[model samples]
Target: MRQYLSADKEKELIETANTLMAKGKGLLAADESTASMLKRFQSIGIENNEENRRLYRQLLLTGSKDLANYISGVIFFHETFYQCDNNGKPFREILKDNGIIPGIKVDKGLVPLAGTNGENTTQGLDNLSERCAQYYRDGARFAKWRMCSSMSSTSYNFICCSNLSERCAQYYRDGARFAKWRCALKIGDGLPSELCIRETSNVLARYASICQQVLRKFSFFSGFRTD
Candidate 1:
Protein backbone atom coordinates (compact mmCIF):
# COMPACT_ATOMS: atom_id res chain seq x y z
CA MET A 1 0.00 0.00 0.00
CA ARG A 2 1.41 3.43 -1.02
CA GLN A 3 0.18 6.99 -0.70
CA TYR A 4 -0.55 8.95 -3.84
CA LEU A 5 -1.15 12.55 -4.84
CA SER A 6 -4.63 13.96 -4.98
CA ALA A 7 -6.17 14.85 -8.36
CA ASP A 8 -6.73 18.56 -7.80
CA LYS A 9 -3.20 19.11 -6.57
CA GLU A 10 -1.87 17.03 -9.41
CA LYS A 11 -3.60 19.25 -11.95
CA GLU A 12 -2.27 22.34 -10.24
CA LEU A 13 1.31 21.12 -10.33
CA ILE A 14 0.97 20.10 -13.95
CA GLU A 15 -0.08 23.64 -14.77
CA THR A 16 2.80 25.12 -12.81
CA ALA A 17 5.59 22.99 -14.18
CA ASN A 18 8.48 24.74 -15.90
CA THR A 19 7.06 27.54 -18.05
CA LEU A 20 9.58 26.68 -20.72
CA MET A 21 8.05 23.25 -20.96
CA ALA A 22 4.75 24.80 -21.89
CA LYS A 23 5.89 25.63 -25.43
CA GLY A 24 8.06 22.68 -26.43
CA LYS A 25 11.11 23.92 -24.56
CA GLY A 26 13.85 21.98 -22.79
CA LEU A 27 16.85 22.73 -20.60
CA LEU A 28 20.36 23.07 -21.91
CA ALA A 29 22.78 21.21 -19.65
CA ALA A 30 26.15 22.92 -19.46
CA ASP A 31 27.19 21.77 -16.01
CA GLU A 32 29.85 19.29 -16.98
CA SER A 33 32.83 18.76 -14.64
CA THR A 34 36.19 20.38 -15.37
CA ALA A 35 37.63 17.09 -16.48
CA SER A 36 34.55 16.31 -18.52
CA MET A 37 34.53 19.78 -20.08
CA LEU A 38 38.17 19.50 -20.97
CA LYS A 39 37.45 16.21 -22.65
CA ARG A 40 34.57 17.83 -24.50
CA PHE A 41 36.86 20.65 -25.62
CA GLN A 42 39.43 18.16 -26.81
CA SER A 43 36.86 16.79 -29.20
CA ILE A 44 35.99 20.28 -30.48
CA GLY A 45 39.65 21.36 -30.90
CA ILE A 46 39.22 24.23 -28.43
CA GLU A 47 41.56 24.90 -25.54
CA ASN A 48 39.97 24.74 -22.10
CA ASN A 49 40.69 28.31 -21.06
CA GLU A 50 38.67 30.48 -18.73
CA GLU A 51 38.08 33.04 -21.47
CA ASN A 52 37.04 30.33 -23.91
CA ARG A 53 34.56 28.87 -21.47
CA ARG A 54 33.19 32.30 -20.65
CA LEU A 55 32.85 33.27 -24.27
CA TYR A 56 31.17 30.00 -25.10
CA ARG A 57 28.54 30.39 -22.43
CA GLN A 58 28.13 34.08 -23.02
CA LEU A 59 27.46 33.35 -26.63
CA LEU A 60 24.77 30.87 -25.68
CA LEU A 61 23.33 33.15 -23.05
CA THR A 62 23.23 36.19 -25.31
CA GLY A 63 22.63 34.34 -28.53
CA SER A 64 19.09 35.26 -29.55
CA LYS A 65 15.63 36.06 -28.27
CA ASP A 66 14.42 32.92 -30.02
CA LEU A 67 16.94 30.96 -27.97
CA ALA A 68 14.97 31.81 -24.88
CA ASN A 69 11.86 30.35 -26.39
CA TYR A 70 13.29 26.82 -26.47
CA ILE A 71 16.08 26.88 -23.92
CA SER A 72 14.51 27.26 -20.51
CA GLY A 73 17.59 27.19 -18.31
CA VAL A 74 21.37 27.11 -18.48
CA ILE A 75 23.24 25.01 -15.96
CA PHE A 76 26.52 26.68 -15.14
CA PHE A 77 29.83 25.67 -13.66
CA HIS A 78 31.31 27.75 -10.84
CA GLU A 79 33.44 29.62 -13.31
CA THR A 80 30.46 30.45 -15.47
CA PHE A 81 28.54 31.74 -12.48
CA TYR A 82 31.10 34.50 -11.99
CA GLN A 83 31.43 35.31 -15.67
CA CYS A 84 29.49 38.14 -17.27
CA ASP A 85 28.34 39.31 -20.67
CA ASN A 86 30.21 42.10 -22.46
CA ASN A 87 27.63 44.52 -21.05
CA GLY A 88 28.83 43.58 -17.52
CA LYS A 89 25.75 41.85 -16.11
CA PRO A 90 26.17 38.49 -14.42
CA PHE A 91 25.16 35.57 -16.60
CA ARG A 92 22.79 34.48 -13.87
CA GLU A 93 20.97 37.77 -14.13
CA ILE A 94 20.95 37.57 -17.89
CA LEU A 95 19.14 34.26 -17.86
CA LYS A 96 16.57 35.29 -15.28
CA ASP A 97 15.62 38.43 -17.15
CA ASN A 98 14.58 36.25 -20.03
CA GLY A 99 12.44 33.82 -18.02
CA ILE A 100 15.21 31.24 -17.80
CA ILE A 101 16.35 29.72 -14.55
CA PRO A 102 20.01 29.73 -13.68
CA GLY A 103 21.32 26.52 -12.16
CA ILE A 104 24.61 25.30 -10.70
CA LYS A 105 26.37 21.97 -10.71
CA VAL A 106 26.92 21.36 -7.02
CA ASP A 107 28.38 17.86 -7.00
CA LYS A 108 32.14 17.85 -6.27
CA GLY A 109 33.07 15.04 -8.65
CA LEU A 110 32.76 11.33 -9.23
CA VAL A 111 34.40 8.52 -7.28
CA PRO A 112 35.14 4.92 -8.02
CA LEU A 113 32.25 2.52 -7.42
CA ALA A 114 33.71 0.07 -4.98
CA GLY A 115 34.22 -3.40 -6.50
CA THR A 116 32.98 -2.17 -9.88
CA ASN A 117 35.84 -1.44 -12.18
CA GLY A 118 35.45 1.76 -14.24
CA GLU A 119 32.10 2.60 -12.62
CA ASN A 120 31.67 5.33 -10.01
CA THR A 121 29.40 7.32 -7.72
CA THR A 122 29.11 11.09 -7.39
CA GLN A 123 31.21 12.64 -4.60
CA GLY A 124 29.38 15.57 -3.03
CA LEU A 125 27.60 14.35 0.08
CA ASP A 126 29.75 16.51 2.37
CA ASN A 127 27.67 19.56 3.36
CA LEU A 128 25.62 19.16 0.17
CA SER A 129 22.31 20.20 1.71
CA GLU A 130 23.86 23.42 3.02
CA ARG A 131 25.45 24.10 -0.34
CA CYS A 132 22.10 23.65 -2.05
CA ALA A 133 20.47 26.13 0.30
CA GLN A 134 23.10 28.69 -0.59
CA TYR A 135 22.61 28.05 -4.29
CA TYR A 136 18.87 28.44 -3.93
CA ARG A 137 19.41 31.76 -2.23
CA ASP A 138 21.62 32.70 -5.16
CA GLY A 139 18.70 32.20 -7.61
CA ALA A 140 18.86 28.57 -8.56
CA ARG A 141 15.39 27.15 -8.92
CA PHE A 142 16.39 23.54 -9.56
CA ALA A 143 19.30 21.11 -9.24
CA LYS A 144 20.49 17.84 -10.66
CA TRP A 145 22.23 14.84 -9.10
CA ARG A 146 23.45 11.91 -11.13
CA MET A 147 23.69 8.48 -9.50
CA CYS A 148 24.55 5.10 -10.95
CA SER A 149 23.27 1.70 -9.91
CA SER A 150 23.32 -1.74 -11.42
CA MET A 151 21.34 -4.96 -11.46
CA SER A 152 23.60 -7.95 -11.59
CA SER A 153 23.59 -11.50 -10.46
CA THR A 154 24.59 -10.46 -6.98
CA SER A 155 23.53 -6.84 -6.77
CA TYR A 156 20.30 -5.96 -4.95
CA ASN A 157 18.66 -3.19 -6.97
CA PHE A 158 15.98 -2.47 -4.39
CA ILE A 159 18.45 -1.52 -1.69
CA CYS A 160 20.49 0.58 -4.08
CA CYS A 161 17.43 2.31 -5.53
CA SER A 162 15.96 2.93 -2.11
CA ASN A 163 19.14 4.55 -0.83
CA LEU A 164 19.53 6.76 -3.89
CA SER A 165 15.92 7.93 -3.80
CA GLU A 166 16.17 8.72 -0.08
CA ARG A 167 19.18 10.94 -0.69
CA CYS A 168 17.43 12.77 -3.54
CA ALA A 169 14.32 13.37 -1.43
CA GLN A 170 16.46 15.11 1.17
CA TYR A 171 17.95 17.21 -1.60
CA TYR A 172 14.49 18.46 -2.48
CA ARG A 173 13.70 19.16 1.18
CA ASP A 174 16.69 21.48 1.38
CA GLY A 175 15.65 24.06 -1.25
CA ALA A 176 15.22 22.64 -4.72
CA ARG A 177 11.51 21.99 -4.95
CA PHE A 178 12.20 21.13 -8.56
CA ALA A 179 15.04 18.64 -8.83
CA LYS A 180 15.82 15.59 -10.86
CA TRP A 181 17.71 12.42 -10.04
CA ARG A 182 19.45 10.95 -13.08
CA CYS A 183 19.65 7.30 -12.15
CA ALA A 184 21.64 5.32 -14.70
CA LEU A 185 21.97 1.59 -14.90
CA LYS A 186 25.52 0.49 -15.57
CA ILE A 187 25.63 -3.31 -15.45
CA GLY A 188 22.24 -4.74 -16.05
CA ASP A 189 22.71 -7.75 -18.26
CA GLY A 190 19.58 -9.49 -17.16
CA LEU A 191 16.48 -9.20 -19.26
CA PRO A 192 13.34 -7.58 -17.85
CA SER A 193 11.12 -10.28 -16.42
CA GLU A 194 7.78 -10.18 -14.64
CA LEU A 195 9.41 -10.38 -11.23
CA CYS A 196 11.97 -7.78 -12.14
CA ILE A 197 9.35 -5.35 -13.38
CA ARG A 198 7.17 -5.83 -10.34
CA GLU A 199 10.07 -5.48 -7.95
CA THR A 200 11.35 -2.37 -9.69
CA SER A 201 7.93 -0.73 -9.62
CA ASN A 202 7.51 -1.59 -5.94
CA VAL A 203 10.90 -0.12 -5.09
CA LEU A 204 10.18 3.03 -7.06
CA ALA A 205 6.74 3.42 -5.50
CA ARG A 206 8.19 3.18 -2.02
CA TYR A 207 10.80 5.73 -2.97
CA ALA A 208 8.14 8.17 -4.17
CA SER A 209 6.12 7.71 -1.00
CA ILE A 210 9.13 8.52 1.13
CA CYS A 211 9.91 11.51 -1.07
CA GLN A 212 6.36 12.84 -0.75
CA GLN A 213 6.43 12.52 3.03
CA VAL A 214 9.72 14.41 3.21
CA LEU A 215 8.49 17.07 0.83
CA ARG A 216 5.23 17.48 2.69
CA LYS A 217 7.22 18.26 5.83
CA PHE A 218 9.29 20.86 3.96
CA SER A 219 6.63 22.63 1.87
CA PHE A 220 2.88 22.68 1.51
CA PHE A 221 2.96 21.24 -2.02
CA SER A 222 1.57 18.12 -3.58
CA GLY A 223 2.20 16.01 -6.68
CA PHE A 224 2.90 12.50 -7.87
CA ARG A 225 6.21 11.13 -9.12
CA THR A 226 6.25 11.07 -12.92
CA ASP A 227 9.28 8.87 -13.45
Candidate 2:
Protein backbone atom coordinates (compact mmCIF):
# COMPACT_ATOMS: atom_id res chain seq x y z
CA MET A 1 0.00 0.00 0.00
CA ARG A 2 3.01 2.30 0.03
CA GLN A 3 3.09 4.49 -3.08
CA TYR A 4 6.58 5.60 -4.09
CA LEU A 5 6.15 6.63 -7.72
CA SER A 6 5.10 10.18 -8.68
CA ALA A 7 2.11 10.90 -10.90
CA ASP A 8 4.37 11.46 -13.89
CA LYS A 9 6.25 8.29 -13.18
CA GLU A 10 3.04 6.32 -12.96
CA LYS A 11 1.83 7.79 -16.23
CA GLU A 12 5.11 6.99 -17.91
CA LEU A 13 4.91 3.40 -16.74
CA ILE A 14 1.37 3.01 -18.04
CA GLU A 15 2.17 4.55 -21.41
CA THR A 16 5.22 2.35 -21.92
CA ALA A 17 3.19 -0.71 -21.04
CA ASN A 18 0.42 0.25 -23.45
CA THR A 19 2.91 0.76 -26.22
CA LEU A 20 4.41 -2.68 -25.67
CA MET A 21 0.95 -4.22 -25.78
CA ALA A 22 -0.11 -2.30 -28.87
CA LYS A 23 -2.15 -3.91 -31.64
CA GLY A 24 -0.57 -6.95 -33.31
CA LYS A 25 2.53 -6.64 -31.15
CA GLY A 26 3.74 -9.15 -28.57
CA LEU A 27 6.73 -9.68 -26.35
CA LEU A 28 9.69 -11.90 -27.20
CA ALA A 29 11.09 -13.61 -24.10
CA ALA A 30 14.78 -14.02 -24.74
CA ASP A 31 15.88 -13.99 -21.15
CA GLU A 32 17.01 -17.57 -20.73
CA SER A 33 19.61 -18.06 -18.04
CA THR A 34 23.03 -19.35 -18.93
CA ALA A 35 22.24 -22.91 -17.93
CA SER A 36 19.01 -22.90 -19.83
CA MET A 37 20.70 -21.46 -22.86
CA LEU A 38 23.37 -24.11 -22.66
CA LYS A 39 20.82 -26.87 -22.77
CA ARG A 40 19.12 -25.30 -25.75
CA PHE A 41 22.39 -24.90 -27.62
CA GLN A 42 23.46 -28.42 -26.84
CA SER A 43 20.25 -29.75 -28.28
CA ILE A 44 21.12 -28.04 -31.57
CA GLY A 45 24.82 -29.12 -31.58
CA ILE A 46 26.10 -25.60 -30.92
CA GLU A 47 28.70 -24.65 -28.37
CA ASN A 48 27.44 -22.50 -25.50
CA ASN A 49 30.36 -20.15 -25.12
CA GLU A 50 30.26 -16.38 -24.65
CA GLU A 51 30.91 -15.53 -28.28
CA ASN A 52 28.34 -17.98 -29.57
CA ARG A 53 25.80 -16.70 -27.09
CA ARG A 54 26.47 -13.15 -28.13
CA LEU A 55 26.25 -14.04 -31.80
CA TYR A 56 23.01 -15.89 -31.35
CA ARG A 57 21.42 -12.98 -29.55
CA GLN A 58 22.77 -10.51 -32.04
CA LEU A 59 21.18 -12.46 -34.84
CA LEU A 60 17.88 -12.50 -33.03
CA LEU A 61 17.92 -8.81 -32.25
CA THR A 62 19.08 -7.64 -35.63
CA GLY A 63 17.87 -10.35 -37.97
CA SER A 64 15.21 -8.25 -39.63
CA LYS A 65 14.00 -4.67 -39.70
CA ASP A 66 10.41 -5.91 -39.64
CA LEU A 67 10.82 -7.65 -36.28
CA ALA A 68 9.60 -4.59 -34.42
CA ASN A 69 6.26 -4.90 -36.15
CA TYR A 70 5.44 -8.03 -34.22
CA ILE A 71 7.98 -7.93 -31.38
CA SER A 72 6.96 -4.92 -29.36
CA GLY A 73 9.38 -5.74 -26.55
CA VAL A 74 12.24 -8.13 -25.77
CA ILE A 75 13.13 -9.46 -22.34
CA PHE A 76 16.89 -9.89 -22.12
CA PHE A 77 19.23 -11.63 -19.75
CA HIS A 78 21.97 -9.75 -17.91
CA GLU A 79 24.58 -10.72 -20.44
CA THR A 80 22.51 -9.48 -23.38
CA PHE A 81 22.02 -6.12 -21.74
CA TYR A 82 25.65 -5.17 -22.32
CA GLN A 83 26.03 -6.82 -25.69
CA CYS A 84 26.22 -4.93 -28.96
CA ASP A 85 24.81 -5.83 -32.34
CA ASN A 86 26.94 -6.60 -35.39
CA ASN A 87 27.02 -2.90 -36.18
CA GLY A 88 28.52 -2.02 -32.79
CA LYS A 89 25.25 -0.51 -31.64
CA PRO A 90 24.09 -1.54 -28.23
CA PHE A 91 21.23 -4.02 -28.29
CA ARG A 92 19.11 -1.71 -26.23
CA GLU A 93 19.66 1.16 -28.62
CA ILE A 94 19.01 -1.05 -31.60
CA LEU A 95 15.68 -2.11 -30.17
CA LYS A 96 14.72 1.40 -29.20
CA ASP A 97 15.69 2.84 -32.56
CA ASN A 98 13.41 0.26 -34.16
CA GLY A 99 10.52 1.22 -31.87
CA ILE A 100 10.86 -1.82 -29.67
CA ILE A 101 11.09 -1.80 -25.91
CA PRO A 102 13.89 -3.58 -24.03
CA GLY A 103 13.36 -5.36 -20.75
CA ILE A 104 15.41 -7.54 -18.34
CA LYS A 105 14.74 -10.62 -16.29
CA VAL A 106 15.57 -9.69 -12.70
CA ASP A 107 15.00 -12.86 -10.77
CA LYS A 108 18.13 -14.54 -9.45
CA GLY A 109 16.62 -18.02 -9.60
CA LEU A 110 14.30 -20.19 -7.56
CA VAL A 111 14.86 -21.09 -3.93
CA PRO A 112 13.01 -23.48 -1.71
CA LEU A 113 10.30 -21.91 0.41
CA ALA A 114 10.97 -23.38 3.81
CA GLY A 115 8.52 -25.67 5.57
CA THR A 116 6.96 -26.82 2.37
CA ASN A 117 7.17 -30.04 0.41
CA GLY A 118 9.30 -28.65 -2.43
CA GLU A 119 7.52 -25.33 -2.91
CA ASN A 120 9.90 -22.71 -4.30
CA THR A 121 10.10 -18.93 -4.68
CA THR A 122 12.13 -16.59 -6.82
CA GLN A 123 15.15 -14.89 -5.31
CA GLY A 124 16.86 -11.53 -6.08
CA LEU A 125 14.75 -9.12 -4.03
CA ASP A 126 17.78 -7.86 -2.17
CA ASN A 127 18.85 -4.38 -3.31
CA LEU A 128 16.12 -4.61 -5.94
CA SER A 129 15.53 -0.86 -6.04
CA GLU A 130 19.15 -0.15 -6.75
CA ARG A 131 19.32 -2.79 -9.47
CA CYS A 132 16.12 -1.61 -11.12
CA ALA A 133 17.26 2.00 -11.14
CA GLN A 134 20.50 0.98 -12.80
CA TYR A 135 18.69 -1.10 -15.38
CA TYR A 136 16.38 1.83 -16.15
CA ARG A 137 19.37 4.08 -16.61
CA ASP A 138 20.84 1.47 -18.95
CA GLY A 139 17.80 1.71 -21.30
CA ALA A 140 15.58 -0.99 -19.85
CA ARG A 141 11.93 0.00 -19.80
CA PHE A 142 10.51 -3.11 -18.12
CA ALA A 143 11.50 -6.08 -15.94
CA LYS A 144 10.44 -9.66 -15.25
CA TRP A 145 10.51 -11.81 -12.10
CA ARG A 146 9.46 -15.45 -12.29
CA MET A 147 7.95 -17.23 -9.27
CA CYS A 148 7.43 -20.97 -9.64
CA SER A 149 5.54 -23.55 -7.65
CA SER A 150 5.53 -27.32 -7.92
CA MET A 151 2.32 -29.14 -8.72
CA SER A 152 2.31 -31.36 -5.71
CA SER A 153 -1.15 -30.65 -4.36
CA THR A 154 0.29 -28.48 -1.63
CA SER A 155 -1.41 -25.34 -0.32
CA TYR A 156 1.11 -22.83 -1.65
CA ASN A 157 -1.41 -20.23 -2.73
CA PHE A 158 -0.99 -18.09 0.37
CA ILE A 159 2.77 -17.93 0.14
CA CYS A 160 2.80 -17.41 -3.63
CA CYS A 161 0.26 -14.57 -3.57
CA SER A 162 1.86 -12.75 -0.64
CA ASN A 163 5.35 -12.98 -2.11
CA LEU A 164 4.22 -11.88 -5.57
CA SER A 165 2.23 -8.88 -4.28
CA GLU A 166 5.08 -7.69 -2.12
CA ARG A 167 7.70 -8.10 -4.86
CA CYS A 168 5.49 -6.64 -7.60
CA ALA A 169 4.94 -3.47 -5.62
CA GLN A 170 8.62 -3.24 -4.82
CA TYR A 171 9.65 -3.72 -8.45
CA TYR A 172 7.16 -1.09 -9.67
CA ARG A 173 8.42 1.44 -7.16
CA ASP A 174 11.94 0.73 -8.35
CA GLY A 175 11.05 1.75 -11.95
CA ALA A 176 9.89 -1.45 -13.60
CA ARG A 177 6.99 -0.71 -15.97
CA PHE A 178 5.69 -4.25 -16.14
CA ALA A 179 6.29 -7.77 -14.78
CA LYS A 180 5.63 -11.44 -15.59
CA TRP A 181 4.93 -14.43 -13.33
CA ARG A 182 5.02 -18.04 -14.45
CA CYS A 183 3.02 -20.77 -12.79
CA ALA A 184 3.46 -24.30 -14.01
CA LEU A 185 1.19 -27.29 -13.66
CA LYS A 186 2.10 -30.92 -14.33
CA ILE A 187 -0.52 -32.88 -16.19
CA GLY A 188 -1.13 -36.61 -15.92
CA ASP A 189 -3.92 -39.10 -15.91
CA GLY A 190 -4.77 -38.44 -12.25
CA LEU A 191 -2.88 -35.25 -11.68
CA PRO A 192 -3.71 -31.50 -11.83
CA SER A 193 -7.02 -32.11 -10.09
CA GLU A 194 -9.61 -29.48 -9.29
CA LEU A 195 -7.77 -28.42 -6.17
CA CYS A 196 -4.51 -27.64 -7.99
CA ILE A 197 -6.29 -25.76 -10.77
CA ARG A 198 -8.34 -23.69 -8.34
CA GLU A 199 -5.34 -22.86 -6.20
CA THR A 200 -3.25 -21.74 -9.15
CA SER A 201 -6.06 -19.59 -10.50
CA ASN A 202 -6.67 -17.97 -7.15
CA VAL A 203 -3.00 -17.21 -6.68
CA LEU A 204 -2.71 -15.71 -10.16
CA ALA A 205 -5.77 -13.55 -9.61
CA ARG A 206 -4.46 -12.25 -6.33
CA TYR A 207 -1.09 -11.43 -7.86
CA ALA A 208 -2.73 -9.65 -10.80
CA SER A 209 -4.87 -7.52 -8.51
CA ILE A 210 -1.88 -6.48 -6.45
CA CYS A 211 0.07 -5.59 -9.59
CA GLN A 212 -2.76 -3.27 -10.68
CA GLN A 213 -2.70 -1.58 -7.29
CA VAL A 214 0.90 -0.59 -8.02
CA LEU A 215 0.08 0.52 -11.57
CA ARG A 216 2.17 -2.10 -13.34
CA LYS A 217 1.12 -4.28 -16.25
CA PHE A 218 0.96 -7.93 -15.18
CA SER A 219 1.32 -10.97 -17.38
CA PHE A 220 0.65 -14.54 -16.31
CA PHE A 221 2.21 -17.54 -18.06
CA SER A 222 0.83 -20.94 -17.23
CA GLY A 223 2.86 -23.99 -18.25
CA PHE A 224 1.38 -27.43 -18.76
CA ARG A 225 3.96 -30.19 -18.88
CA THR A 226 3.94 -33.87 -18.19
CA ASP A 227 6.79 -35.24 -16.11
* The candidate that achieves the highest TM-score relative to the unseen native structure: 2
lDDT of every predicted structure (CA atoms):
0.56, 0.65
Native-to-model Cα distance after best TM-score fit, residue 121 in candidate 2, in Å: 1.1
Over 1-227, each residue of candidate 1 has an lDDT whose tens digit, in order, gives: 44354566445434434342456777688776667778878999999988788888888778787878888756677677778998889888888898886766665665655544344556665566566666666666555555544446454444334334223332232223444454445234453334434543554344334434433221122233433
Q: State candidate 2's TM-score.
A: 0.71
Clashes of each: 0, 0
Worst 10 residues of 1 by lDDT: 215-224
RMSD of each: 7.2, 7.9
How close is every model to the real structure, measured as TM-score? 0.65, 0.71
